[model samples]
Target: MQIVDRIRETFRENAAMLREIENKADAFFGKKNLQTSLMQSITMLTTRWVKMPVTP
Candidate 1:
């Protein structure tokens, strides 16, 4: 339960960080730029998840 709670909290923090990044990207660039960069970021994150190592 404690580990689950910590994971939930970490996810919430990450969501907030992602929102801030999107806002900053949109402000400095534009919707199109934000879309492109966000797609790239998603791809990178997906790749990382796919390649994540498993511990025994």
Candidate 2:
């Protein structure tokens, strides 16, 4: 039960983070926004994204 709860919490946190990153990326690329390079944008986003375990 505890493991299940932990998994659920983690999932929720990841979802929120994704939304925030999307908004940030859009603002960084959208109209009247910073003209950051594509590599920089991807790197920034990928860095914060979860460093998850590999499951098969």
Candidate 3:
């Protein structure tokens, strides 16, 4: 009975840790995604500006 309780407690602790890690990973990726999106937008705007003909 004691061994069973120990295993159950261990599993619960591991599950909580895993959830925390997953949340952190999700947040990290979310910021990365936002950065990527902003870079793409900047690149597109720069390309458009470069392609425009210069007027005196």
Best by TM-score: 1
Give the CA lDDT, 0 to 100, for residue 32 in model 3.
76
TM-score, candidate number 3 = 0.53
TM-score list, all predictions? 0.57, 0.52, 0.53
Off by over 4 Å in 1: 36-56
Q: Candidate 2 residues 1-56, lDDT tens each?
A: 99999999999999999999988888767834544566678888887675656689
Model 3: lDDT of residue 54: 100
What TM-score quantifies how close candidate 1 is to the native fold?
0.57
lDDT of 1 at 12: 100
Q: What local distance difference test score does each model get?
A: 0.94, 0.80, 0.90
lDDT of 3 by residue, 1-56 (tens): 99999999999999999999878876977867867988999999999999999999
**Which of the predicted structures, 1 or 3, would earn the higher lDDT when compared with the native?**
1
Q: What is the C-alpha RMSD, rounded to one decimal, of candidate 2?
A: 12.1
